[model samples]
Target: MSLLSVRSLTRSLAQRRLLAIDELCLADGESCVLTGENGSGKSTLLRILAGIDAPDGGTGCFDGRPFAWRPYPDWLRKQVTYVHQQPYLFHSSVIDNIAYGLRARGVPGAERERRVAEALSWARLNHLLDTPPARLSGGEKQRLALARAWVLRPRLLLLDEPTASLDADSRRQTIELLRTFADAGTTAVIACHDRDVIELAAMRRLDLVDGRIITD
Candidate 1:
């Protein structure tokens, strides 16, 4: 069964229609790579699904429950996570940043610490646990953001241009991390043009054109 399903989704900017999708579905544990030209609405679609932006019109089902945009169903919020090209980080240490979501969700201290430690190792950030986010390199920061979300163990993850600004080595590291996530059964929809990401063994491709998914 699909974990997410949307129908007749649409979005506009002033009079310009930014996105229009007749339907889109993702199965549990699926990995999808979104491809399109710069203005083909890749990011816009990701933002809408992430609930960071609302669609002009649409209906969705997540985990067999109704989903919404304006209020962004509270239950869905706990099940989906989004990370941008330039992720926002706390002003504190790496460990603290990864623990923020857990703390907010009222996870017990012992369990929180355990998850944070696992996340640190997952992102290969264990050595930098005490370092502030500001001190990290671009790739490191992106890893931190992924780790932050990973610690929450959200059922779905939406990533927009996650490797857009990284060097080759960093990009490779990021891809490895994504592979780890996929291995752990975390569903993902990634917007990217990188051939390596597009060719990931676990990913199926979706191409957006003229504000619509032209290929799947």
Candidate 2:
């Protein structure tokens, strides 16, 4: 079954058209790459898909149900997670940052600790658990961001240029982690321009031009 579906999706910002997608669908365990030049609304579309922003027209569905617009559904929020190009880390220890989601969902002490530990290990940030996120290096920050997202095990993961600011090795490792998520049945939609990310994702490419999907 398709995990996500978008039809005639459109968006505008400050009276300027930002994105207009005719049709898009992502199946369970599939990854799709959204590519476009700067200011082409790649991030805008990602935001819309992640339910961070609402489109001007058209409809979207998650798991075959009409997606709620005003006040996003709790169930949908659990199913989809968006990781920004520059992750926003709270003013807290790395462990706290990784544990934020579980805490929000009311997952208490023991299980939360276990999930946080597993996520830190998976993102290779186990050693940095006590360190402050602000004191971490760029790559470490990225890993922490991934760890924050991973603990939830979201069904539809939306990433915005996840490897754009990483070094070669860090980028490779990030791609591998994303692949691992996809293999484990987490559908991913990544908006990126990195060649390595595109190649490694092995996704159907959708090219956007001036906010419209031009090729797929």
Candidate 3:
């Protein structure tokens, strides 16, 4: 069964239609990209799927259960995570930022430390462990954002232009980490135009036109 499914989805603002997806589905461990021109509703779709925004109309299901995004249920919140193009970070140290979610979820202190250490190594942020998240370089901040989410081991990840403004090396490192996430069975939907990201293993393309999926 699909991990997530949606049909007859619609969204509009100020009397302007934004999305009109007839049907869409994602399988467990699947990696897909959302491609479209600006205003084509890629971010809008990601926000709805991430439960950050509600659609005007739609029926959605996840893990064989109805997706009640309006109220944004606790179970779904625990299962899904979203990262913006310019991700947000706390005014705290990198290690603390990475441990924030685990702490909120009530993960044991030792386990949180272990996971934060693992994440730091995984994202190559060990060197910046004590640096303030807000003072890090763009790529460093992005990696921190990803590491923070990855530590939670979410089943589904929604990323908006994750590689938008990075240098070549930074982009490569970020893509490698994303590949690792996919290999570990985390379903991901990334909105981006980067060639490296588009060509990741087992990555499928979903092109949007005028807020509708033109090809999948």
Candidate 4:
């Protein structure tokens, strides 16, 4: 069975149709990139999939279960994770920011520390553990956001224009980290316009035009 499935999904804004997808499925361990022009509703789709926003109509299933987001809020909150294009970091140290989710979920202190350590090591931000995330560079901030999401061990990750505002070098670095995450087995749905990111292996492109998916 597909890990995730959506049918007849629709969303409207100001009485205008913003998105209307007939069907979509994500296989386990598969990664797909959502490509589209500005105002094509890419971010809206990601937000819906992330459970951050519910579609105005249609149904979603996760692992063969009724995954209508609102009714299964707890399940979605635990299993799905999201990172915005410009993620917000709490007004705190890097480690603390990364550990915030764990704390909110009531992960034990020792385990939280270990998970945070692993995330920091993977992001190569261990040296900046005590540094304020607000002081981080654009690339560093993006990495920190990735690390924060990485530590959660979510089944599916939704990213919205992760490298859009970054410099070339920083964009390259962020994309590499995303590739690494996908390689190591996290299901990712990325919405990006970066050409470098589209070439990653095992990544299927889904393009949206005029709020409709023309290719998948």
Candidate 5:
């Protein structure tokens, strides 16, 4: 069975249907690049999958267990990670920020540091470890967010336009990091307008139009 499955999913706000996905399934270690225009429900689907928002009506299964429309269980929440288009950075050093999630989860001091280090290596942000968020560039901040998520080692990584406004070099770096995630067997659902992200080997393309998936 797939690690994540959604059946008859629908999300509506103020009586307007935002999404109506009949079925979607993601096997463990699989990844999909979600392409859609603004307000086309790409972000909504990520939010719902990440369990940050509840659907209007749906049946979702994680690891073969069922979940109704509501706040997710602690374990389920831990299994999903969502990075915003403009991820919020706390007022702190880069390394400190990356280590925040593990710390919150009460991961041991040594383990947190170790995982943070691994994340730095994964995102290639080691040099920026000690830098303050104010001093970092847009791409650096984006990388920092990705590293932060990496440290948690969530089962499903949701990225919302992670490379949206980056420079050429930054975009290249971001794409490389995503490729590393794929190589490591991390299941990721990336919602973006950039086709460059589709170059990742694990990524299968899916388009969202008028709140419905148009799979080919």
Candidate 6:
């Protein structure tokens, strides 16, 4: 069974149709790239898949069973995390921002420290750990956001324009980190306009047009 599946999904906002997906599935460890123009509902579909929004019509299943949004299962919650285009950090140190997820999941002191350190190293933000996240550069902020998601070791990750604001070098590094995560069996769905990211991800590309998937 697919790790995630959506059947006949549809949604509308403010009396306007936002999404209408027939059937989509993502296998364990698989990655897919969602590409489309503005107002194509790419982010809307990602939000639905991430469980942040409900579909007006259709069913979603995890491992062949109905998926529930409330009181999220620990296993499932740990398995999926979403990173938005504009990341928000707490009014605290960068270390605190990256450690937030671990604390929320009840990970204890030592383990939390270890995971946070590892994530910072991976995102190349080790030196800025004690700095205020708000003071960091745009690339650093994005890296902090990615580190937050990565430390959880999620089995599925949904990224919305992850590298949109980074410089060339930073964008390359971010893509490399994403690839490493995917290689370690983390399924990913990325919404992007960057050709480099799309090519590097080597994911099945889908185009959303006016709330519908456009067939090639």
Report the C-alpha lDDT of model 3 over 1-216, residue by residue, as the tens digit: 599999999999999999999999999999999999999999999999988899999998999999666787888888999999999999978888899889889999888899999999999999887687878998898999999999999999999999999988888888988999988999999999998899983468999998899988
Ranking 4 against 6 by TM-score, winner = 4
- Candidate 4 deviant stretches above 4 angstroms: none
lDDT of candidate 1 over 1-216, digit per residue (tens): 799999999999889989999999999999999999999999999999988899999999998998778888877888889999899998988888999989888999999999999999889998887688998999999999999999999899999998999999999999998888898898999999999888773458999996899999
Model 2 lowest lDDT segment of ten: 66-75
Residue 50, candidate 1: alpha-carbon lDDT: 87
RMSD of each: 1.1, 1.2, 1.0, 1.3, 1.5, 1.7
TM-scores of the models, in the order given = 0.97, 0.95, 0.97, 0.95, 0.94, 0.93
Please, what is the whole-model Cα lDDT of each candidate in the order they appear? 0.91, 0.86, 0.91, 0.87, 0.86, 0.85
Tell me the tens digit of each residue's lDDT in model 2 across 1-216.
888888998888898989888888888888889898999989998888777988888777888898755666778887888999989999989999989988989998999999998998899987877788998877788888888889999898899999987888888888878877877878888899988778866768889998998988
Give residue 180's lDDT in candidate 1 (0 to 100).
84
Clashes of 4: 0
Q: Residue 119 CA error for candidate 1 (Å)?
A: 0.7
Give the range of the ten consecutive residues with the poorest summed lDDT in model 6: 67-76
How big is the positional error of residue 116 in model 2, measured in Å on the Cα after superposition?
A: 0.7
| Model 3 poorest 10 in a row by lDDT | 195-204
Residue 83 of model 6, lDDT score: 91
- Tell me the spans in candidate 1 whose CA falls farther than 4 Å from its real position: none
The positional error of residue 135 in candidate 2, measured at the CA in angstroms, is 1.1
